[model samples]
Target: MKNQTTTTSVTTGQMFRFVFGQVLNRRWLLGLNVLALTVISLLEFVIPQYEQYIIDHVIPRRDLGLLTEVVLGLLGTAIALGVLNYLSTYYMGIMSQGAITNLRTELYQYTLRLDTHFFESSKTGDLMVRLTSDISNLQSLISANMLSMIGSIVTFIFVWIYIFIINWQMAVAVTLTFPLMFLIYRVFRTRIHNAFRAARASQAQMSNQMQNTLTQIDLIKSYTNEDLEENRFGAYAQTNKQDMINATQNQAIFSPLIDFVNYLGVAIILALGAYFVIRRQLTVGQLVAYLSYVAMLQGPIRAFTQILNQLQQSLVSYGRVMDILALKPAITNAPNPVNFPAIKQGVTLDHVSFTYPDSDVSENGPVLPAVTDITFTIPFGKTTALVGHSGSGKTTLTRLIDRLYDIDSGTIGFDSVPIKDIRLSSLRKNIAIVSQDVYIIDGSIQDNILYGRENATDDEVWQVAQMADIADFIHSLPDGLATQVGERGVKLSGGQKQRLSIARALLKNAQIVILDEATASLDNESEKAIQHALENLMKARTSLVIAHRLSTIHSADQIIVMDDGHLVEQGTHESLLKANGAYAKLYNAQFS
Candidate 1:
């Protein structure tokens, strides 16, 4: 995982660089955007010249011939400006959409590769907002915001220079008002930035609440808590609405104030230019050109204000995204990882100890001492069952063996090489787990079995299905292997779902198998069938079985009993029953 730093304030040059980096691969779009913007600016610059020509030449002469020519010129300029403006906006739309796709793909890929710890701390909805809204805002900055900023600055400079050339006295008079406008804008900019930031935060908080409500809709219904959930959602929505109203109010007030100042500047220019004309210091045509320049300049200044607000919002969104990108995966493979081919020996836990990252020892806290300094070994070609009461760390220990988490204080090795050093792909490839809770996809039985390994032959699918005793059940269905499982396998009974999960694990043909209470939720018939399948699957593979019912583990080569986080006993069923330890006590209580 790559850790990203918070982008509190990005420089204009840096933002340009980032936008360019995102678009570098899309050269066609880049060329189109540049070409369009240039043509549009060129058309706009020609406007003042056209106005001057019409005012001085055609009007003074009262010549219809020259008037017709001036009208044609103005019409041509309007048509060209409209065409160029359309092209610029059209190309920007295409680029913004493409850039959004690229950014979204990268963000999703990076998020998936992040370590489990990051997920433990972040909410799904918050991460989702970062993916969708934040990235979209960035695209907005690249497309509309950048273009507006560029166009405004270009127009402001070009128009000012033309005004100076036409009449310096009027240009200077209009220029004098800019310092005050800049000061006023700086204050407005600060308020808008803060307001937009608050709006984004409020929106993210509301999204989080909505997601929570939807995910737990069933729970709320069962508990008859609709009114309570509605109140909670209402509170969140209200907060978001308030923030948006504040932001909109600030923008409304800011724009009108800027417009008022601009009008005042135009009035000043008119007064001064008329004086120059009356005194014969400047021509009427020159005054008309100066006023035209002032009108053009106002468009860019207002545009600048809008772009500044957008830039601030983008910065805030970018900072949120960077917060997630900065998190490094706590569990990852070594740089030069080695492969463990066959698990020739066995899996070993040498004084392994682990504690959850955000847990403490308490009833309400996370399970205490998830795993203590426990040492164990299971030889190849045997079944070793892990039996314990609930919350006795059975599942946690299994997770450690699979390297879902690293033990804090000991070594977990596969064939004697530290598990962390072994290539993660190789380690997981050789192990298969059928957890107590089965998950079925919304697809055919064939699809589910083949999910264990893509490109699996149909023959291989039937073989595992038969081995797990699910082939007969599928054959009885109307669609057989092609039958849909429906949402989360809701169409199948708990026992059927368990059998399918078992079939999935068997299809993997891994050397090390883990059955975490695999048959705990099944009926007697399904349990017997699944247990028989387990026996066949365990023939040559080293197996770790967690069974809630004693009947499921009677044939184990060794049964390890755990209490809280410590191992209390390990022996064959008969031997442990005679030893009268934790395992024996459990067996007698449950099966005697």
Candidate 2:
């Protein structure tokens, strides 16, 4: 959905703000976590000071009482540190999980509101990766890396100030490595981010490939293309492997280089502190305490390098997640939208034209519109038939009336009010479509039927099923309405699925019904029964029927013939035959 070419670069501060905004919602839990971390940091600083007391004061005075007191102080600090650490870790887990849960729910709900065009153009696998794996990356940062980074920062500041107070000269010499380490991070930051981005892309590709291959396993086996698909999958796996290795390669080189710098600082401080002790300018205890402080400082520096690696990876995931959230649906409700009024004058399209956004250019030249300058009406309480070949835009016309897409030109009206002015929910609730391609969820027969009207009574569901002539087949099954239809209704026959779809529409009891080749999959006997049921369903309501079998719509009150996105003819079936125009030719061709 995102147009990468138009996307601007986001700074680190912006990314943090966006991510932390979601995380900081649980203020009480975060407050407790901060309190624990602060206390833990202060306790860490106190422990080394106790070590200095024993060496410089207690041991030198040979005072057993003071030694025991110092030991008891050390024990108390360690216990307090342990308890605070537990509380901090526990509280952070709750905070991070809560934040991620809310974020995921919001992302999914927003994604559902996006236009149909977005789904048509995007791969399911890639979207799944964004929703699941990408979000998990952010969770990992919050739960583990982010909290640790905060602690490291606190420790670094406390130890740095303490070391400087004890001996500024040694502290100054030790900190020379800081600038070099920072320079190394700056140099590798972009390189590491790019590598991780490549890895995430490759991971998405692999997920998409797996989803495609697995869902179409039937096609693969029928054509005996298993080996072909295997090889293809293997290629994606290999690419992902190479990408991960490349990402890790950047990290592996960067991490140890940071460690080398850190220890080098420690080495320099060790030598300098020993020199100060021999000069009598520093006590042995002070030198030991200073070395401990330097080690404490190195912990944060080393942690910072690891945190840098995670920060880069988390940014990549965050960017991917944000890209989806940034997209605004092309089709949205108008401001102050009113509910669609009850139909009286029927539906009208005046010089309507539309071209799909994802339409591709052909060898001839630019892409052509799917429909053009079409003006027609479906009279209220009458059956109107649309007769056309494939890609003649009959389906597109139905989609437009339902407001699944907006027309590029002209106006579509319902009872003299513009379709766009009506509330989308109210408009769609009045229309029911039973398309040729029926999609049944992995649910029970009752569940699928109930999808049409969520609050419909069980008796009402059965009545519609009986009217659609699917009751007989349903009765034959052991579980009847309770029978499970496997994924996409793979367990059902073609005609059965179509009938189930009709049963769904019948239960909807909408004011306007569009049957696009609804009976195309049915046998002659089933088609006749469905036609009779549809006649009853269409009475006192507007109906638009599309079928290639011209005989199917011969009894319609009005017929419209379309060719290559243009309306070519309109008349009753017998009248069209008398004129011997486009409608007549299509009808004759089928019978002859």
Candidate 3:
């Protein structure tokens, strides 16, 4: 698990560029939307001119037939604009949604393929938030919001041309307010950016709390810390509320200010036009046309800034999504992958050494190395055990062999080729693991056993279940193998869950087996059944066992003892006990 509350930096312009770039590849869709929107913008420009013509020409001449014709023309064009706008928005929606879905799928797939080191160094909840909320933000930006901003910009450009054509002097006067408006918009943007960052930080904090709380709800209730947890949650929520308020205030303040600027700009335009009309420099109709054009331009102008604000949010989320997409898994298959037929061919670590990239005590603290110069071998069809104290690097050594992590130096090999050279799918296919913390989905007993290997027939499922000694109990159940195991197999006892996990491994029919504290969670009866299952599974396979209980690995063909990233002892259990070293001390301490 990663430490809480690490900050991410993503700017608005970068996000817009990334998202827009994604759209550039879809030339057909882009052409369709832009063309439709262009027609709509052209229609919008015509509406103001048509109104000006009706007032200046038809009304002055008092020709009712001309008046009726112009009214119908404007109505027809208005309807056409609406249709074009709908078409543009419709196609844009499809393109945006498709892009977002594609991006999200790739992001999700990349996250799953990342090495265990990345997962260990990152928070699950933060990743979850990125997958859900951040994706949603991007989706909105693409689908509806972004297209509207594009339309606004197009409309502003067309309206500005009309304003300039009517009277240059008046156009210049209205344009002057823009710089002050932009200055005020800049101030609003700064405040809103800070507010939004705070809002996202609070959200991240809240997500971490929820993930921890839900996972450990039983612990909270057992320790009577529910109230404490609630207090912590509420405190974070309060910060979220405050951040939202600040963002709302920062953005909301701009609306009235912009409106005031619009009002003042219009007032100045009309007053100047009135003086020109008195001086016979401009007519009533020309003044009215300029005023109408300015009014039309104001909305699109204000909308442009509002869209820019939303763009900032999308950019932040875009950065987060890009981060996950760009993260290369530390452990990946070689360019030309090797395929291993079976794991019984044995495995070897030739001078393997490993240290976590970001696992350090402090800035200048001594870095801990988890494995060092570890040269060892487990021969084919043999059961080998690893014995170590906590933090002695036992788990790290197992993970190294599994290639959940890559070794910093030397090589780990199976079938005479480095594990890294083997295709990831082929490598994992040959091994099965039964760990202390067994996981079962909320599914039928059969489904849990055959998870991912679900095509196994009824006979095959039952065959493995019997070997794991879970068939008899499953048969006794009213639903047999169809019995629904509740979330994470909570419906079953610890011993029962362990047996089910063993059955799963048996069903895999893998050539290598790893038992990581597999029987530690069980009672004697359950442990005996699991041991029986292990013996059956290991018959023709190589096996590596990590045992806390001393008697579990007593009959192992070999035992390797580890302490502080180094091998302290290796031999048969009896020989190690006779050696009276770290292995002997551990054995006596547990069994004495």
Candidate 4:
């Protein structure tokens, strides 16, 4: 989430550690693939020797019977190797899929473990790229030619040994070029790396822009700023285009640079080979075979750069994923936490202070700490309403109680036990919230309500729906409880959505309930309907409500008024108005 550049220059071996570890999970199958590749390499190596022998012995001697036998042997090896190739490729797919599936699943589960702050600063679209596109890149990187590279390595070593035995001078001539090739690669490597890094950055930026634009499509259309959005997206696309061009340029040059080195080696082999043949030290077939070796050598030579480029691209994705994995949640359950079944007394906050984390603090000019040295207690079975102007830390206080964010200082405890000493699941299960921003998943209305209590009965669901005044709406639909809510309840009006949320909370039946402006969007009639439901839902439960309309909470057991993150007054609404303080001012501003 921080704006610092990610570290991305790890060696290919280092980049492949995770992949190799994953491959080992299907080690036997992968081992078979390796074995098959080894056979293919050995058979291919034998074919060149057979070609040389047929030219030097069988053809010159005109032994049709020997030629027939030799040709048949070659055919048999090819057939066997072909079968092996099929098995290797088929099972390699199985291996790659298995590994990538596990990796993606682990990444998703790990992302879920991260606290609220991580999602707050991170982009959903960028994370999607890491999970989907980036994860996809890793497969080709490992499976594309790993087996071929292995085969090439085996063949290269064996071929070199054979060629050296036949004529070490020609072999030596070819060997000299390797160090020079490596040196050339060293020179171009950094430029290639930098180009890939730039391209990856551009890709991430483009993905982020596209994701944000699509998510806010409604806002763009509502404000008639579609052209503005289009221009912004085009800029990202153009930047990506330039990055791709730069990357392709570097990649395009590297292969030729390597090819040039390989050509130099071949040239030296050719010139020396002629001298050997003239001196009666070598035959033409041997020279041809040596040339064949040189040609075969190109497989690995080209593979090296090809593999390196794909790896660099994959590591760029890896670096993004590692960045998320590196974060340790700021909020987590204590190693030893209370296993209390329920809260015995009440919830209490003592001198708690909190400031939201920001990547660009300077731009915000120090957020001035949303909640500072504020303390309060909500007695069990009592409704405590928070009254304050917007941005006065009312919602922030409730968030702290839920332990969504840890406080900068001081303690909040439940039943004399610090909330931090309670398991996170235990803490959350006991608290239910109906926030102003209603989040309804795409599912049937009953399916949404069942989210409140995973195993709530059909009758219980209907009962809570009645309390929230949404049962009639559900029953009137053709499908009743099965009627779809669409994405975020897009089919429902604002008041309908609010009632559905209330129904979910009532069904949850948590001991500690926080209703932060739950009815803020409802009209007077809808508000009255929800108010009656709230009374039923709040019965004998500790409730913390933040009211947009002052009149809604006049009957609340206690009213706490806040200003600029400080608790300015606390008492009954009538008493606060009599005191002529912050609460009175807020109430009079709305009702006077």
Candidate 5:
């Protein structure tokens, strides 16, 4: 089977364009955000006008009466500014939070829908960064952070307009230095982008290294390699440190350059205004107002520069995130797939064969089939046991049946219907597989059991717990079903975790069940107990089992014996024992 998953790399500009369209769905909220900021900006402009009135009119006339009015205007403006600021911040916050929430939720669901191969070629740490850190960085840009920047831009523009009206010549002289700010950004923009990108890469490596150590802590200690692991962690930390330093250094350079450019503007305005005042072209009150406007411009200019830095960081993050969003899953439902109500007959493998997918294959290199010409029929409501040594393609057969991986050249049919035509949801929902190693969620015993069916009644949960033979242990605990299982169910024994897994399956009540060496690793007592429970549960259901122990399959309806990649024998257990072939040899060797 051939499948293609294309991950087309996109640039930051393309990613930004995509994001703008995505957030447009919340256009009403975004519009309200703009309205609020506009009000705040107008109010900010009104306050500066009051400052100009006090300096130009009140002080020059020595008018005490205008002083009272000016003080009242300032007080009133301050109160209005507070309220407008709150409204502006609140609406933008809502819009930003809503945007990020939608993006994060969609990305999470998309990750879940991705096929097995995508994860095989990806790293958990990098994925985590996309979901957590990258999403968070984007969130800041969409919300309050963005609103603040917009307000700054409005301030810069409005203040410039008033300064021109107050003294055209001085306005031109002062703002001449504004182009210098652009030149400074041009010099360092690429450096900052590269620094942040490198920092993010280094962060992912550190996260991966940390995750590796935490997951394998026991092995590290058992091998007494604490010092080695510490050194490795130190190396990752050093790389991360250097990357952050580079990014921070660029940020540091950005702030000071912004300050120098803005202050230079102020100095130019002061010198020109003083000359104009002496030449009788500008009044003292007008000169004072000009100085005040220059000061106001300083905050917005610096703020906008900081926002530019944030924008660069946001663009880098979005570029990485879009790369994941653009990938197509290897396996997806076919157009007009057949949805089976139920499997009425049985599974049939007619001349089936498979080979593992090899991405590293070279021309003229050897290729090997994992299973070759393997053919069999599992009759409905019966157990077929696959008994073989490791790497004998036993588990591979079950995986193909479950559609975890597609076979190379084969017709795998459920009830004689080709599996490829079936709807994946319907197929997976009706089937369940219990592997040798069970993944137990860290939660209450009841929570783990109820995870199989969210809407299952507590009575239904208790019944399955009993059938799986885990009810007694759960009841003996003080917390009963509510007892915590710890991480990966570490609080429970291996046998306990296996039974808990069975309880989960029992809750799902799938029609087809595949047991992959479920009882192979347990003690004799645990094995006997779980096996008896499994036999009871397997009744009236289609069960395919891979057993490491020969005795476990003695009563299996049909026994399949495989050697290398070929099926060497197939018969009932006793008939296979009498054949004096591969199955007989394997059985005798195990017992003897």
Candidate 6:
């Protein structure tokens, strides 16, 4: 299968628009936040004016009453600033949280709908990182840093205009350094972004390694390869550590350089203001106020450097997230899809062919299709058995029947209805599969069984469990149906897990049943019991069974033998044995 990572590149402008678009979902909250920030910026500008007045007028005139009044005005402005800051923060919290929550949910829902091909080519750990860590990065950007960056811009604009009004020459002198700081940021921007991207990739690799190792810990222990696994994991961790340090180092260097340029701007303002004040071209009070304004102007410039760092990292995360969101599921319902009817004629395949989209190529040429030009019929209310060697396309045939993948050529029909024409949800709901590799969720026994039929009553659940011959096992457990099954049903034995799978499939009560080595995990006694249960489950249903054990299918209504992706033999078990063809060969080998 292809291992290429799916990625979508978006321009900086596009990224901002998308993130802000989510924030805009709560329009009123965003509007209120902007208003609060604007008032706070104006209040910040007003405070410097008060400082100028006190120094130039109140102190010189020695008017106690005027001083008291100006002080009261400053006090009131401070209170207003506090209130506005609180409201702004609160409003931003609501907007950012709501936006991130909605975006995260949308991403998850989209992922669930994606085709199996996408998942086969993707790592579970990397996908988890994108959904969780990457989303969290965006939340931080939107909630705290982004609004603060906006406020800084507003404050800078107000302060810049005021300083120019008080003294144009000083404003012009300090402004020269502004371009140099921007130049520094522009020069370092791509480098910082590249570093952050590398870090993010490294983190994904590390997460993938951790997930892989943890999931297969039992295998590692079986072979006593814990040290080997640990060493492998350590390598991933080391790479991640280095990449993060590299990103942090780039940010560290970038910020200080910007700060150095900002200090240069401050020095120019100081020298020019002092010269003007001494020469009587500017009042000391006006010079002080200009200095204060210059300080305010520097705030945004400094903030820009920090924001740039955050912007680079957030952009990396944004790209990762958008890459997933941009993907359109390969398998989607046709326009005005036909609702699947109850099965009567059963499934039919007419010269069907399928090649996995990501199938690996040999050095000489491309590999053969998984199933090639196959044709067969699964008649209603009958059990048809498929016997094949490993990789003989038996399981692939079952998946094709269920429309897990669309055939590359010809067609698969469900009760004479073209499978693709049927609504995907409706088609899948009517088919139930019990495969060799049973998957049991980490939940109570009842929860896992109910997954097959969520609305099934307690009595109905027990009935199916009894039919699957697992009711006695449940009764023996202290918690019975409520018994906790650890992650992947780790608490249960293989036989128990398989039995639960049978119970779940029995509960689904689907019109078509597929048993793909369903009894492989069961012991001799359990297998005998489950075979009886299977007889009941398959009765009056269109059933398809794939088994390596030839003995199990002796009573099947029809037996089909497959070899190297081709149907080689078909007949009743006795006829196939009498013919002594592929089915007889497999039967004799197993029996011998």
Instruction: Report every candidate's CA lDDT.
Output: 0.80, 0.85, 0.81, 0.83, 0.81, 0.86
List, residue by residue over 78-185, the lDDT tens digit for candidate 1.
998788777778777887787779878988998887776667667777788889998888887767547655666777788888888877877888788777778778
* Global Cα RMSD, each model: 3.2, 1.9, 2.4, 2.1, 3.0, 1.5
Candidates 4 and 6, the one with greater TM-score: 6
Model 1 regions lying over 4 Å from their true place? 1-16, 360-369, 523-526
Clashes in each model (backbone N, CA, C under 3 Å)?
3, 0, 0, 0, 0, 0
**Which should have the higher TM-score, number 3 or number 6?**
6
Ranking by TM-score, best first? 6, 2, 4, 3, 5, 1
Tens-digit lDDT string for candidate 4 (44-143):
8877788889988999999999999999998998898888788878888888889889988988999898888778777676788778878888787558
Residue 373 CA displacement from its true place in model 5, Å: 4.2
Model 5: per-residue lDDT, tens digit, 381-414?
8999998889999988987887877878879998
Taking all chains together, the TM-score of candidate 4 against the true structure is 0.95
Prediction 6 TM-score vs. true: 0.97
Q: In model 3, where is the ten-residue run with the lowest total lDDT?
A: 1-10
What value of lDDT does candidate 6 attain over all alpha carbons?
Answer: 0.86
Best by TM-score: 6
Comparing 3 with 5 on TM-score, the higher-scoring candidate is 3
Q: Where does the lowest 10-residue lDDT sum fall in candidate 4?
A: 1-10
Q: List the residue pairs that clash in candidate 5.
A: none
Which pairs of residues collide in model 4?
Answer: none
lDDT of 3 at 113: 89
lDDT of 6 by residue, 1-592 (tens): 2343744676778877888899887788777787778778889889888988999999999999999999999999999998888878877888888989998999999989988888988988899999999998888767755787677788998788877887888888899888898888888898888888888888898899889988898998899998898898889889888888887888889888888888888788779888988899988788778878888888887876777867888888898988887777768899989987788887888998898886779899878999888888888889899998999999999988888888899999988999899999988888889987989998999999999999999999999999888899999999999999999999988778887888898898889999999887677787776787788788788999998777888889898788999989988999999998988888899888
For candidate 3, the per-residue lDDT at 418 reads 83
Candidate 5 regions exceeding 4 Å error are 1-26, 165-168, 295-299, 351-358, 362-369
TM-score of each: 0.90, 0.96, 0.94, 0.95, 0.91, 0.97
In candidate 2, what are the lDDT values of residues 1-592, reduced to their tens digit? Answer: 4343222356667777876788778777777787778778788888889988889999889999999989998999999988888878888888888888998899999999998887877888888988998888888767755776677689889899988888999999988889999899999899888888888888888898899988898999999999998898899889989988887898999988998998898789879888888898898888888888888888877777787767777788888887888889878888988888888989999999999986778999988999999999999989999997888999999989998899999999999889889998989888989877898999999999888899999899999998888898999999999999999899998878877888888899899999888877777887877776777667788999998678788789899888999999998989999998888777778888
